[model samples]
Structure formats: C-alpha cells, structure tokens
Target: MDTILFYTPGTCALAAIVTLEWLGQPYRLCRVQKAERQSEPFLRINPRGQVPAMLVDGRPLLESNAILAHLVDRRPELALLPRHGTWERDIANQWLAYLASAFHAAFWPMLMPQRYTLENDCQATVRQAGEEAVRRELRRVDTYLEGKDFIQGTRPSALDAYLHAMSRWGNSLVDMAKDHPNLWRHQKTMARDPAVRFGTAVERGEPPPEPHALVGHVELASITL
Candidate 1:
C-alpha cells in the first residue's frame, strides 16, 4: 500500500504513527509544521485542518480515532481489537469515542483558552476549568486501568498507544506521576516501545534510526499535495 501520514508533532497522530511502525509496513511521514497546519497545503488534505490525517493509496483518511480503527482493520492479525459484533468490540468503540470526544475536548480550553472566551481576563479561568475537566477524566481512565495493564488487557493494543498519546498531554497538564500512578505506569511502559520511541524521535525532527520502515520525512516544500 502507498501510505503517507501527515502529522504535527505531539498530537494524537503519534499513536497512529506508532501503530504503523509496529505493523512494520513500508510508509512515509509528512511533518506539518504547527504554524502552517491551517494553511492551504494541509487544508487540502483535511478540510478541518486537523492533524493525524493520512493518504492510503492516495485516499484521504481523517481523524485520529478513525485512523487507529483503520489500522486495526488493516492488520487484524495483530489482534489490536476484539472480534466484531461482540460486547467487547462495543466497549472498545466506546472508549475510542470517549477519548476522541469528551476526553480530547477537555484539553481545548487548557491548550487554547482564547477560543473559549472573548475576554482576556476570562482565559485563565477557562484554562483552569479545562484543567479541572482533564483531571477528572484522568481519574476515570486511571480507574479503568486499575486491574489491566492496558485498556483491553495485558496484550498491548493500539488503544494503549492512543492512551499514551493523549496522556502525554494530560501528564503535562497535571502531576500524573504523583497523582495518577496507573496512567503514569502505562505512559512510561509505552514510552519504552521502539515504535513509540521512533515516533517521538521523529516528532523531535530526528531521522528515524537505520534499517527502519520509514521511507523518509517530507516537508511541504519537498512534496506535492
């Protein structure tokens, strides 16, 4: 498959990138500079100007959760998800929806409080509200992982990668290490993964190490839309 992932560093795109690395499939990366994400070039790829968009065989796939689910469907042998039509599958879908919707929305005011309010003085309060929301959600996730190593149990799935990515933002907003031990453990363990490391290194503008499946990194100046 001709696959190319368009991402901005530190976004949820990291999860999909890590999953692709684990699949060991030949692919390429397109790093969209944050300042230029909403510009014409990226807007052409995803009208919403979102990160975590991809071109699979020249077809566009947008949204992080959709990308993760597609990866599972593409490589079912990995068993990253449970079987279809079962309660397990429904529960898994529920988690994905929650992460993408409520969990992710909670970070907006914290990350971009200006969007939430018109008054400059109100931004701080808006941000605080977002932090409170994030903390509450983090506690919920911690409780969910109380007895399991990952969201779906012991075997590492794409879900863990998703959690790891979102939790990176969550960790920055709160003292995850001190307050949410279970989430902290999950984050640290996933960070040790070579695939996760590769995604992180690339996000930092480093070339992936030798003998990797990554075709190469592309900048807007270097490639056509």
Candidate 2:
C-alpha cells in the first residue's frame, strides 16, 4: 500500500495529507511547485492539473474528497470516519460534499476573478462578490458548529482537516473569532493536532528538515490498491 501524494502549498490537498497522517500510514509526498502543477509531467499524471493527486501503488487518484474517502475505506480500523451504514457516516459524507461543492466553489472567483469575467474592471467586482459569498458560506458553517466541536460532533474527521485548510484562505480577509466564533474555535482545536500542523507546514512551503514529521518519499513506478 504505497501511497504518493502530490500537493502544492495551501491547497485542499492538506486534507489528504492530514488524513494519511491520522491513519498512521506510510506514504510518500510530492510537493509540486505552483508553476509546475500544470506542466506536462503533472498534467500527464492528472489531466485536471490539480493538487492533492494521490498515487496509490502507482494508480493515480484525483479529487480530494474521493481520495480522503478512499483512505478511510482502506483503513477502517483507524475510525478516521464514522461507521458504515450509519447516520453519522451519512452526515460526514454530507460535510465532505459541502466542502467539495459549496465551500470550495466560493473561493474560485475571489482567487481567480479573470475566469469569472472578461472585462478587466469587472474583475474587482467579481472578486468582491466572491469574498462576500465566502463570508456567507463560512458563517453558515460557523452556525452549524454552534454546539459541535467537530463536523461530526466530538470526533475530528477528515472534514475538519478540509475545513481547516479552506478556512485559512478566508483568514486574511475575515477574522473568524470576531465573525465566526464556532468555526474559529474548531480551527483553533484542529491547529493543536500534530497531523494538522504537519499538513499545513508542508502547504506553507516549509522546506525539508522542518519540525514536522510528515515528509514525501521516492515516487514509485507503478502499483494499485
């Protein structure tokens, strides 16, 4: 079960890295540079040219949600996720879906306004709109966490890792404590975890020999689950 994860700084790929850490699985990390993500070599591996591309024994896997889910599936003993055929698991899946669709979508326009509009001047408007949407969505998440320490109640799941990474994108623009205390509290709790710190440090472009434990290894030629 050799796993290789390709990621860039501060992307949702942190979720996969964190999940692997939580599972205590021996895997490899490939820190793809921002400029090289869309390069031919990476594109050949993942046509989407996205970060967090995990190669399990040489079988390329894309999509952070699916990759995280697959990790949970492979290591049920870790209880990284809720039990199968249970409402708790369903709720966890819902959170993952929301992060994949709603939470992640809100950042696109703000990060890449040109993709939303053709007019140069309208880019600001698009960015502003995106920022507002991000705030609204984040607020909703905060409200949802009013009485819950994690997305699935008391336990920290991959959803927490995903939310922690995504929430960082908004930290510069919005103060979570002042605007979204519940979510802010959750993020603070998540930050204390070594796995979360390791994933985030790598995302922040931390070089080798840092304080973090998780690090990438040599890439494999080919293998599958």
Index of the highest-lDDT prediction: 1
To one decimal, what is the Cα RMSD in angstroms of model 1 from the true structure? 1.5
| Candidate 2 lDDT by residue in tens digits, 147-219 | 8998875778888888988887888889878999998898899998888877766667665334443545543
Candidate 1: C-alpha lDDT:
0.86
Check candidate 2 and list the clashing pairs.
Answer: 29-216, 57-223
lDDT of 1 by residue, 93-171 (tens): 9988998999889889899999989999999999999999999999999888887788996777888888888888986
In terms of TM-score, the best-performing candidate is 1
> Candidate 2, 83: how far from true, in Å?
1.8
How high is each candidate's TM-score? 0.95, 0.91
Model 1's TM-score against the true structure: 0.95
Candidate 2: residue 39 Cα off by (Å): 0.5
